[model samples]
Target: MSLLPDSAVTSAPGLRRAQLLLARQALEAILAAQRPADAILQDLFRDNRQCGSRDRARISELVYGVLRDLRRLQAIAGVQADAGALCALRLLDQGLADAATLEAWGLTASTALARRLAGFDPATLTPAQRDNLPQACHERLVAQYGEDATAALAQALRGQAQVDLRVNRLKATREAARQRLAQEGVKAEPTPRSPLGLRLSARAPLQNLASFREGWVEPQDEGSQLIALLVGARPGDTVVDYCAGAGGKTLALAAQMQDRGELLACDISAARLKKLRPRLQRAGVNSVVGLALPDETALAKFAGRCDAVLVDAPCSATGTWRRNPELRLREPDFAALQALQLRILGDAARLPRAGGRLVYATCSLMAVENDEVVRAFLEQHPEYVREDAGEILRAAGADWQEPELRLLPQRHGTDGFYAVAFRRQGE
Candidate 1:
């Protein structure tokens, strides 16, 4: 599993240079591939086993810092700045490095670059660059949320995300899980909203913890936990997670149903569905049936039979920018994404029986992918009536009260999420 050979692992003397070098390489790969920074760095660290804890800490900070404020760094460093240059600029801005440090890393700090970085003004930045968003994404946000709201959302997205966990009710109560995690030196407090959620004060090696290993808790966003709660699936009901990639929501739904319902987890990718098997076993869930789609005849059999259906459709993931900053650099094709979302909603709509509930949700802030998609679906399927998501969630103990539930990182301290529930008109 190690990516690097034995020769590359260095002792303490060259550790600083090694860390910088690794950070540069990792950042370059992330920028070029436009992949998740977390995944890319996991691969990089795996290859270089010689990297100590400190080395990994430094590397991750540099890589994520550069990505979090990339456009501004690009403005000061250069539009085509290399990873090394960006890293140097980031260090300089944070007061983590100086001229000598850059020189030691074989990098140059021009007077202009230094001046611009030190005296950088928000007034000087273009709206897009100020928001750290690609031009297309900026324009889209402005069109959907207006300039002022978009800027606030952008500011929220630039901040870091806290780790949240959803206690597996099947395995333990929230208080019991908290106590067990604390015994293992992990500090967490109950989340403000979701009854089953906990917010960790800092990241810990949760995978090695007995609580996680035994599935007493699973990492999930509070907003995501709220979405599962909104589904309102009960024991003995038949529910379907229509686009269940890796079964996060499916698992949560099973817990909601008290592991006594018929829960169908369906996804187009069999490989993705395969991942849910181990998770299901670990969570001690027995009600789930994983299905890989394109089995039209098979899925059709469930039509008008399920009590509830959840369409956590794929989207541009703009609401998740706080955790996945790399997405800010890429331009998503909104037209195509909209069309696909609408189509998926239509397909999922058929699964809920008459008078059954359907909740369409996305981790997206864009109207085209959130409200627009749902409204479009309503226009096509008049038999489905939109319900107040806030009312449903409030009865379940959430503070929200809007017609459609929109969770924003800035306002709610959670990932940006949108959910709208609907009920079939006839019984």
Candidate 2:
């Protein structure tokens, strides 16, 4: 495993050892700096541009795998162990390396990690350890989904997320998009619940595909696509995507409108809203107008005028844990987040005209952020009435049939999302 040129072991196992060490170093930086794993990885790749594609992918997989199960790895590696021991423990537990191979790699240096993980019985570990969930998360899961379903949801989130794309029908139909992806060396199939959604067989370099660059496809989770569908924006109607960060749903709504309606994409961050212009242009979305928020006059103009309003409120983002495993390490301020969610709901709830629909959506699995917020908002604003979510899904041609829509990673193979639609009644 010598890295020095004079004693360099160029064998595959030696290279593998070197790579794992590097990954562990990066993981240490991620935890120490408290930075997003994806951002840190991007920076690492950017600085070491000489690394091949395979090397980058392998490194990313190793890093994310460890991050996903950091809690379990830590419990096994002991509180005294460093990041290197944690990585070693994860690789061994995953059976990525045999004891003999690990010994050659650095077993002496990682004795504590190896001893702890080897002696540790996975079944004896608590649910938090077995499922790599925070101990705090278990109680909340029970409160949200009861005991049985909570375990199921936790296990589902422990798996990797599927790569999903939204077919921009403005440029190509779902069938055409599927065919185009196939021709580009990427195999894809239509998502069962989203007519315009395509699930890739494996994650591929999307930017390299012609369909993506040509605006025929945009990478999006099926759950997110469903949230846009819940909005039910239509042609000749004015729609508002309040809090549309970078306007992913805004683009979808424009396509649903056949690019024939007024669609305002608003966000508090000007920097994020600025990104929407290029995406809108690329998607051939002609009906979207991006607006930075806190502009009293701007928001007032759309008040009580939109046929549809989508409040894609911010939350803990626990639903996206599969894709962003780093978030699993942080604790959420539930009280502050819920208060903010209610304020945003109240603000966005004003845009829907009488008889018009306002959809509240969150990429969160927590009931406090989804149902509780909706209930509070409904109580405050009696002018709005909740709509049948399953009825809307059926009308949108989705095969789903539940009174409420809660797409989970394990259940639906999509990012966890909770959406409830309501039509503002005339007072």
Candidate 3:
């Protein structure tokens, strides 16, 4: 397809045609390589420098909407739909496309295409098959968006996700941040249970907002904000943020300490820590002492000195599928995550002093990463005991949960997260 110049698509008719064409091309690339939807959209923006920001945003929304609801759309279309074909089907489903849209995209709503699609009975396909095709075809479909077969797919496809932000308490209160954003023509409502969270009804480009630029707010999920609250860093106490990648929660911890306590923020990646530097400055956080740990020797320096240790271990990020549905495409493999969690939990446990609290957190919905990891760690170290996270939050005047702080998109309107807290034996 020939790339059209922005000026050529200045008219309404021309813009709609360009959007359809771009959506088709982006879907084809996704199907061809199994690229993540976000990555595909980014590549589309990069490749089509002529496309304006509005055009890119519109195309991305349409593409992702179709990907999110491909299964249901295929059911409605009643055919074995490929990725490129799914884009057309979605346009039809949304009433965004008519006979003209297909033709404009250089596609003939051909009899042959219809016949091929009509041949397969979407009803006949097994639920799993409908959600995620066989492994052989999985890659192709995933390349085309076939991996979204989970039971939660329907929910994810039906709704538009809201923007969540955590108020930077170090810079401003949630009410103050809300007021600041309101003056800038953005609407925000406080999130329940998270003292520092605000939910945006409409998604706005936050970086352009004066409130965001002035460090009054930080883009963070409500569940993530709660995770930091669970850490409960107190003034004069020493805390450690193990696996503090880019220090999102680390800064929150610093804020909770009122910038009075010492916070040792440790991460394996120096590159990620470097990124946190600017954020620290923006949040006016000074209590955090950044530490790059290349190996265990680095972790050894501050062993048994921390009062509270937060191990936000890495996982498959199953919890964040609402924000990035592409993660559902990832193969459900616990082996690598299990190994990494073991190392992180072990290292994190060593960092806390006797009687210190250890909070293990993951943006993962899996049992293996949340409950099982904690169970295993407790078994190995008899001196540690699981604390009731829900009770702890309640005692802190925040309403949350223990057993499982699992936040499902359908249930909590937040990312799926699993957090558990533990306390060591008294000195």
Candidate 4:
């Protein structure tokens, strides 16, 4: 096949090819063991110094897109379809691949494989089987594209997610950030619930952007911003951001307090806390006192002193699957994560003084991680009562409402998040 001119390619074809290769490598790494896709992508980009920005973007997109739809694609192609073959099928479905492209890459498009897909009927597959299919198949195309057995195998594939940023209110307003971003050729709109949130129309290289460099905005999901908002850290309040990795929400809390509160940001990781220092400085957040805890014993020093504590606990980040689609591939292990959740909750709860509020938040969609964890914590500490998360947000001046403060991408155009606010019964 003749090589098309630069204009004929939707994206750079050369970059696409590099991305496809890296994506296959990433899949192989995942099959080897559980690893975060973002970390893997960063390592890949770092190793291949020759790869440019466009190549990195294309590779990351292809890798994540395939991961998100791996099961549906596998079911369509047949259960035993390996990662490489499945990725090829996804490219074909997206019209990014053709016979000539495969041939040019020295890949032989097996006639048997093509024939099997040609005769597949997706209508016959069960819902479970369909869900088990690869991530590349679309719901609408289930009938036409997955004819033969492929149609029955096609499941709903999650679409591309927008990049969200939380405007550093300590440095700039949401409107001001939007205007600044516009000057940099980045289009963004205000998020519904977050006073300082903006959702970018498309993912752009932000590392070099002036707004980011100036710390006017921080890359954070809208749902995440809402979690910090639920904390209700008013000026002069003493607050602790437990497990404040890199101080994303901690910084947000500092902003909300208008730099008048004493915000102690504590994390187990010294390295992560060190990184926050520069960011805190750039955001002009002077109220946050970064503390690197050696262990639980170190956290106990601040026990019963904080007026509010925000525990953005660690969990399987299932709610963020849209941005990092590879999360759908994780095998759910409720028992292990539940135990860790209990530990974090108990530890974080210790920091709050009597009558103080504690906001439990997770980027997990699973009830086991969110509601169950909160329920168990409440059971252990009868002194604490569940404050209505919705009520807290309303009091904070949040317009977009929900009963449980749960945010789902399909419903709210944000990452899946679950937050619960609690207050101690009496001082």
**Tens digits of lDDT, candidate 4, 1-427:** 2122345445325435545667778777765657778888788778887777666766776777677666657766675477666667677666666645644554455334455656778776665345543332233224433444333222222566678999987778889999999999999999888777899988788997989989899998888888898999999999999889978898889888988978989888989999998988888888888787756665677788888999888887766666666665646566888898898889788778889999888887667788788889989999899888777887877765665688766667777788888998875
TM accuracy, model 1 = 0.93
lDDT of 2 by residue, 307-417 (tens): 999999999899998888888887787889999999989988888899999998999888889889989999999999999988888788777788778888877888999
lDDT of 1 by residue, 1-427 (tens): 2224435533322226667778999989998996688999999988988877777887888888898999989988766488988887887777666656566556665334567687877687899998899898899889987899888988989988999999999999999999999999999999998999999999988879989989899999999999998998999999999999978899999998989979999999999999999889899998899889878888888999989999999999988988999887878889999999999999989999998999999998888898888879999999999988888888877667787888988889999999999999895
RMSD of each candidate relative to the true structure = 3.4, 2.7, 5.1, 5.6
Per-candidate TM vs. native? 0.93, 0.93, 0.85, 0.86
| Full-model lDDT, candidate 1 | 0.87
- Give the higher-lDDT candidate: 1 or 2: 1
- Give candidate 2 misplaced runs (Cα > 4 Å): 1-18, 98-108
Ranking by lDDT: 1, 2, 4, 3
Clashing pairs in 1: 3-47, 4-47
Clashes (N, CA, C under 3 Å) per candidate: 2, 0, 4, 22
Q: Against the true structure, candidate 4 has what lDDT? A: 0.75
